[model samples]
Structure formats: structure tokens, C-alpha cells
Target: MNPHTISDDKIQAAVALLQAGETVAFPTETVYGLGADASNPLAVQKIFEIKGRPIYHPLIVHIAAASQLSVWAQSIPDDAWRLAAAFWPGPLTLILQRSSQVPNEVTGGQDTVGLRVPDHPVATSLLRAFGGGIAAPSANRFGQVSPTTAQHVHDKLGVMVGMILDGGPCHIGVESTIVSLVHGDAVLLRPGRLSVEAIEDTLNKKILLTQPISTKVRASGMLNSHYAPATPIEIQPADELWIRAHQLANLGYKVAVLNLSDHKKCASSAAITRFQMPLQADDYGRELYASLHRIDHANFDRILAEALPATPEWVAINDRVRRAAQGTTNETRILVRTENR
Candidate 1:
């Protein structure tokens, strides 16, 4: 079946489904979200069941606007307001103290809740119509490639979801930058399109970044090996990436290259596929998920991604790359061996 387009009627139908304690997939600036009513325990349970996500990993609550933040959070810190003013309706998620009104299932039995006001029109409209926060995560199976388009959701959930609100491709293809505010200070839990420097500038206070490895994490996508494709992925320097790609190709393994530059490189074997990401940081972040989604389905034996720049600007993108390539059990090690010519 063709993917359904976004319309008021479709939005109303999705809202009705949520109100009736059902699951739906809706578009957001970051990616499509598999959402359920945050206040309803049963509806929230469906989200976890559908994605096969662990109940220990909490979900983010999407609201219509900043005005609704207090409805879900017990107390909104001053920094949260500043961050919301600077990044809300965009791709930043603020984790705050959860109010009693919020269901435990939505917060994964934690005292804190992650909240965001998506920039996508369809998401805002649906949230407004529902008149409450909606718990949503990337519309894909747990630990799999995230959905950047309506077809991605349909391909994953099929008719299991009551509705799909298509809003074209996502503007920011990766998940939001999640900041936990439970400690009265803004802590950067996850990085995304918004950089750490950007968040610091808004709050005029130094932000503490969580280590890559954390044992006390409460949200999904925080683990080392997540958002991975079926094929194993390896990261290497640009100078060595092509040689490694060709080496893997010659080894009788289907290999694909994800380049972060404009110019395309020559491949010795036709079996090696090359894909270039946008030269700009923002565009690259927006296309990261879609690119991975494609490579995951290309029947490649493994994916060899070129290491991105170590500059501060590329921090978020690199974080996602490392996580995506890391898989569920392996580290994203940099291969430094020379090609045997």
C-alpha cells in the first residue's frame, strides 16, 4: 500500500486512536515517532511491546508547545526554559522531574521525564488535538535503523499501528539531543543536531556532558551499540577507508562506503557501493538515518564508514556514527592496516 499523506482528517483519526489507548506513527523533525498517550499506562505499554524495547529504557514525551511543559514535568528548571526557547520546536529534548500525572510506564518507572516540542507541523497539530503529551520513540524496531519517512514506519509496523501521519522526510534525521535537568543543572545525556557549544551559549552556563558509557542511563539509544544495521560496520580514516573497502570487496564480502565529502572515490570492484554524505554538518545529520536505513537494506555483508572529522562541530554526527557502527556487541574500532598491493 502507498504511504498515506498528512491531512487534518488523518491527524484527527490518529488523535482518536491515541485517546482510545492505541498506538500510531507520526512525523517529527528528527524522525517519525511511534507514539502513545503518555498519561495512559496501557497505551504506553503498546509502544514498548511493538518496538520490543526494554521497559527499563524510557520514552520521550512530545507536546504541542512550551506552554504544555508543566503538564508533564513537576518542575521546569530555568535552564530548561532557556534551552526550550533556543531549541524547542526543533531537535532538543529536555529531561525534567516527572509530575505525578505522568504514568510510570512513560518514564520507565523513573522520576524524570524527557519532553520535546517537535518542529514538524503534523506532530504539533496532533499533540494539540490530543490535548496532552504523547510518548514517542523512533518508529522502528528496538536497536534497528530509525525511520526517517512514513514508508519506514509502515515497513516496520505495517497495520499494527492505527494510523501513519506522513509529513515528508524528516528535517533532522537523527534523534534529539537529550538533556537531563533533574540535578538543577543541564546535563547533556545525548548529542544530536544541536551542539554542546550551542546549548552552553543559550544557558550561559557550562553544561556537563555524560560519558559515552553510562551505567545509570534511563533512556533508549544511549547504549554503545544501537541504531545498528544487520551488517557489521567498521570505521577508518579517510586515507585508508577506500583501501579497506576494496580489500573487503576482494575478500568476497559485499562492502559499501559512506563518505563524508563531496568528491566520489574510485572503487576497484563493482560490488563496492559508495555513498557520500553532505559536506555541511547540518545536512549530514539530517540525512544520516536515511542513509543508514538504505545501507541496512542493500544486502551488503558489511558497511565500512569513513571516520568523520574530530572537530567540535561534528561531535553529534560522529557520536551517531560511532553508535551505529558499534553494533550491539562490538566497539567502533578504527582499522589502521595498510592495503596489500
Candidate 2:
């Protein structure tokens, strides 16, 4: 299919396909989603098949409004309602006990499901017209760079997809912050644009924070190697990264450098591609994924990113960078040179 801008006709067509138990790619503020009728087992199955995503891991259901939450989950906690009011139509997902009406296929046979009302107008329109929750994960093959634009979806899943809603570039450029309330305690399963402090402020109580378990995972994109690029990624201290980058370059490795700022000096012989993120935390968070998307496309032998300050505001971005550097070998420690420090 030709890549075109999103239009009312395209939205209508995509909605129709979803109603017929087929999958379509649509945009949200965070990332493009491969959407299917959450209530339709066959349609949900198609999503897992297309993305090669395992069924044991659940998918997040996108809704048009907070009013639609009860239709998908068994009960909404008071905190969940408060969060919806504060962050709905934004990038926050709530995981709650599923109602019997929610198919096992959508929730990976679990008793809970993740639901969110996206801030994007096109996604909201599609959800409202379809009259049911839509199960949508990022519109990319499983364990690949997520699509932030309509073209990214087309480039990855075109022809394999029934339709693509060209909603332009995603603004948030990351997945939603997933909060699981299924176990009677508010636990943050994944962090996105919504910081833990923001969620705590709305709930009026401290929230439990937990990292994704590598074994027996129940949610999507929880794996360590997820959102990885074809090239290797290394995470190290700011000062010493350039010397290692130069060493890799001398060894015939093409490298890209992502650091906090461009103030650092490196050897002249280094064949390094450098990108400087904003010094401010929120600005850096918003631009994080787009930068990775660009670096992933560059023909680099590896991506070496400098570690950010260990502070509360940088938590979410740190989680993503750490996960991006995770490899099959389960190695998190890259070489750290004392001189660079």
C-alpha cells in the first residue's frame, strides 16, 4: 500500500477492517499500533501472528474514553479513576482485573488486561466508531524498532497489513507507562512519559515500582532485548566513551555516539556519529525514541550511549537505554575506563 496522509476515509476503512476481525496499523501520541478488535479472538490472533508476538504475553487495549474502561475490566480502582482523569487521552496504561467479556486471547489467558485511552484524535475516532476496545501493540515486527510514523509502519508491515492510517509522527515517541492494579496494589510495571511521582501525586499514595521479570513474563515488551536495533549497543560513563568509540573505529567498526551534550572532546581519528540530547530532563525524554530511531537506521556497527545522571526525573529514559543495551549474552557492564572519568 502507498504511504499517504491520514484522512477520514482512511480512518473509516481501517475501522471497517477492524470490525471484520482484521488488523490495521494506526498512530497514537506515543507510537504506531497494530490494532485489532480486542473482543475478536481471530482478529487478536492475527496481530500476534503478524508481529510474531507470543500469545502468553498480553496486549494493551485502546479505548475512546474513560467511560469505556468498565466494559473491558471487572472493576476500576479509585486510584485508576483518578489517574484516568489526570492522564487519559495521554500515554498511560492501567492494568486491572479483566471482565469475562474480555477474551482470553487479548489477555494471554490471564485474568487481567491493560487498557488505555490514547491522546491521538485518529485513534480515539477509530475506537469510538468500532464500539469496542482495540488491542494494539507497536506496529513493528516483534523485538524491532517501533514505528513512530505512518511510513515506519508501511515500511515494516505493509501488504501484510490490511490498512494503514497515516497519522504522521508520534509525539510522545515511546510506549505508555503501564500500571498494574490487578493484585490489589498499585505497581508500576513499565515507565513511559508518566513518571512515578506524577502518578503518586494523583493517587495520594505511594506506588510500588517493579522491573519486568525476564522469566515468566505476562506483559508485552518486557523482555530485556526488546526495542533493540540490528547493531550492538554499549552503555558506559560519559568521559571514557569517546576513547572506546575511537578504538572501535580503528578496529573498522562504524559507531554512533549519543550523549547528554556535545561538549565532550574526542580524538580526530574517531569515525563517530554524535547526537546531543537536551540538558533538560523532560525535553530529553520526549526526544529519546526519535533519536534511537535515527541511530538505528544509520549504518553503524554499534551504538555507544553515555549514561545519564541517576535521578528520579531520568528514571524512565534510563530504563529504556539500559534495555536497549541488553543483549543475548545478558551483559550489562561495558568497559569503563578510569581516565575518561
Candidate 3:
């Protein structure tokens, strides 16, 4: 199937923007990425300056096809190709030794680079039109919620980015599954919409981790306090969320909720913003960032978010929530569901 389904004019415009050392926020199968020309070291530096991202944290180089992977990476192992063959042009990212063609700024002074071929049509079209790797990361600020829609990017960044390709919402709400093969073992660095079990099944080997491999290079989204909003996020159990939010509201707090549970409530108070989320994991993931972006600007005292079930399907959602709730010290009291306890 042809992935260049985006209009030729839009692709050409984005290509022009990128080649001029300006950044463009383009859609991918996973999330919207702030894209810059990977070959230009100064262009890559713009990504860091605009997002306030640390130079030590590298960006993922997105390419149009698997054939172009050799241009940016060197010493590619057969296992990496095997995994890429199975999951490439999709959400799986393979880390390999960086080539001289890829500028040092894109790799954050590391010898390895993160490479992926996004399955999204507009993204592939942009990459093919540009004819080179685009160093892209989530379009949000250094560690805030990611942008799933072009509007989210514009709302957060304003005119900071040269342009944003409106490719609709991202299919997968989170980032890609990062598998590092540079240090002699297939190490699973990050678990995303693609489950670790599925990648292990495809590679047909038990993958190791960063601790066991002892790699020092930092991949994207590895920070402990990331994806957080300007407001604090408190992760509360589903059952107690209503009571806790009510209590806080009674104390003059503006409570905004993102709930996926069937437990329903009709709040009369305007201070509490209740949003019903999708029941399924993928549907929920697809709208996660957009929802957070909307609620974060509502000026709530704190977002009392209800927690999701801990399961393999919810790994990406949980990871984002964990990072979102980092540094928030509000612990809700677990009250027993009894008439008189």
C-alpha cells in the first residue's frame, strides 16, 4: 500500500520547511513528531531549543523506507533486520550504531541512533518528499503530554514550529517500542503500544534490559519526570475518585476528571470537569494526549485522574500516567465501600 496519501502540495511545502532548517510537526502512526532535517546539525539543535529538551537526550530519526536505513546506521545486525522486517513501517524502533551520514547532534553524542519507518501516510509522504531522515520527537514541550492532533501542537507551541501537517489523530497514542541491538543483545528499552511479548515472539529471543546490557546512551522518553502537565496529576483508584474529587471541590478546589470506568456520576458543580474516556485501550490511547491538553488548561487545582487496570494492553497508557503523576504527592485515602465500617 502506498503511504504517500497526503497531498503533493502539502508534502512539498513541508519539504521546503524542513530543508530551510525550520521544524515541522508531522503525524506518525504513533504520535505527532516535531520534525527537522537530521543531516543538518544546526537543524537538530533547533529541536532542542524549541522543545527545551536536553541535548543529551537523543531524537528518533524517521525515514521513508527500510532501504534508507543503511544511510544513517552502520554495522546493522541480521537480527535487527529480522525484527524490522516483521515490525518495520510500523511502531517498532530499532537502535543501531550511527553512521557518519547521521550528524552527532541527532545522536546526542552517542554512537547509536534510533531509527523507525512510521506507517502513517502523511509521515511517509513527508519523509519521501524530503528524501532524508528527519530527526523528530513528540511535539509537546520537553516532558509534557504528547500531541496526538495538529491543533494540540499549535495550541501548545503557537508559531514556534514553522508548520504542522494536519494528518488527523495518531493511531497509536504513545511512542514506539524501542529495541536496542547495538550492545550485543536485543534489549527492550521502552514498551509502547507494541507489547514486549509480541516483539520477543517476533525476534524469537528473550530480550535483555538496559541494566543487564549496561548501556549509557539515553533514548527518548527515558526521563523519570516526563509527560507531566503544568498542573499536578493525582492517580486515584476508580472507586474513590468521586469522593476524593467531591471532597476537594468542597474545599474550593477545581477538580477535572478523565475517567474510563463505568462508575457514573452527575456533578452539579461547575468546578468539577468530568470527561468520559473510551473503554478500550487503543481507543483510549488515541485520545489520551488530546484530553490531557484540553484539561490541563482548565486551571484545575489538580487533575484527579482515575487509574486504569494494570495489564499488558495498558502498558503505554500506564507509563504515560506514571510519568505524568511524577512529583505529585497527593495520596487519596482508600475508603471501604461499606455502610458502616
For model 3, the stretches where C-alpha displacement exceeds 4 angstroms are 1-6, 265-268, 327-341
Ranking by lDDT: 3, 1, 2
Weakest ten-residue segment in model 1 by summed lDDT = 332-341
Please give the RMSD of candidate 1 to the true structure.
Answer: 3.8
Among all windows of ten consecutive residues in candidate 2, which has the lowest summed lDDT? Answer: 332-341
1 or 3, greater by lDDT: 3
What digit string (tens of lDDT, one per residue) describes model 1 on residues 264-321? 4464367788887788778888887787778767788878877777777677878777
lDDT of 1 at 262: 52
**For residue 261, what is the lDDT in candidate 2?**
51
Candidate 2: misplaced stretches above 4 Å?
1-5, 211-217, 267-270, 328-341
Residue pairs in clash, model 1? none
Each prediction's Cα lDDT score?
0.82, 0.80, 0.83
**Clashing residue pairs, backbone N/CA/C < 3 A, model 2:** 89-119
| TM-score per candidate, chains pooled | 0.92, 0.90, 0.91
Best by lDDT: 3
Q: Per-residue CA lDDT of candidate 2, range 1-341, in tens?
A: 32445566777888889998899898899899999999999999999999999888799999999999898987778888999999998999998889888999998888888999999877888888888889999999888778888777887788989888877778777788988886667888887888899999888888887733431226767787787766678887876778777878888988887777565455334578777778877777667767777776777777888878777767667767767777524443454344322
Q: On residues 83-197, what C-alpha lDDT tens digit does candidate 3 reach at each position?
A: 8788879998889999988888998899999999999989878888899999999998898888888888998887999998888888887889898888877887787888888
